[model samples]
Target: MMHHLLFCILLFPLSQLVCAREEAFAIVIPSSRLQCYFVPVESANHSKLIFDYQVIYGGISESEENFGLAASESYSSLTVAAETLRERLIRLRKQLDASEHFQSSRRVYETRDRMLMESKLSRVNFWSFINLVAMITVAGLQIYMVKSLFEDHSRVGQLLRRTF
Candidate 1:
């Protein structure tokens, strides 16, 4: 009797679990050291779009909101890169401001002394600006290259999984 009761309970309305599928997605944005991931409850193959934490983009019907191709192409990626550069620029500007403030105090000195100091300061500032900008540009490019490498790694992983 206990066995029969157990069997009946097991067969009871488990229909809710019958037709669903789960999928995961991951994406590495171009030119930045960032990646996004998503897991869709319904089959990713049935959806036309996907959304991740900070990204949204074109997708295949079977694509879930996972970190797949579409999500990487979203506008969020651009915003991230732009915002990063802006922050760096703001920091550099603050340094420039500090230098300017320091120079302003030298205004009380004689014309000859002030002119000489100003000339030296100006030359240093000009070179500093050039170097800072060049450094930032190179850093940004490196970040982009790293992100691209991440994408390649993920792709290789996927390929390996499928082939194995």
Candidate 2:
């Protein structure tokens, strides 16, 4: 039982790797006059379009067929490279998209913080103005009260002197 479980664990990942390697890709090369499509042998039947350029343009001579096979082998290697580059491009695009999303979220957070600070400052300024007005009104009332008391004392002194 222990050996069976271990084998299954290892086999699962190996199977997945094999499946990944079997993925098919197609490439199309087009010119003004003619176009050619390339696909790996595994996906030949499943291809959406397939044509023999040699047959279309002209029949393949023995020498030309040998040369074409050699060229096809070279192009197959190139296709593998192209598939690798495509995977890298897809990964980079995903990274770029993630970075852009992070930047936008940071901007939104910064804007929210700035608005909160501005709101606090506005409230402070409003309260400070109200406090200043209250202080000034209190000072004015005290000054008027003192002035009225002094004027009443002077009037009483003048009336007492005139009666004497």
Each prediction's RMSD to truth: 38.7, 19.2
lDDT of 1: 0.57
Which candidate leads in TM-score? Answer: 2
Off by over 4 Å in 2: 1-69, 142-164
For every model shown, the clashing-pair count is 10, 0
Please give the distance, in angstroms, between residue 75's alpha carbon in candidate 1 and its true position after superposition.
Answer: 99
Clashes of 2: 0
Per-residue lDDT for 1-164 in model 1, tens only?
56434332233222111122334333334332333334354756565443322223322232332555465577788889999999999999999999888787665456779789999999999999999999999999788655655575666555655676
How far residue 156's Cα lies from its native spot in candidate 1, in Å, is 14
Clashing pairs in 2: none
The CA-based lDDT of model 2 is what? 0.59
For model 1, give the 10-residue run with minimal summed lDDT.
11-20
Per-residue C-alpha lDDT of model 2 across residues 41-75, encoded as one tens digit per residue: 46645444322211123223444434345777899
Full-model lDDT for every candidate: 0.57, 0.59
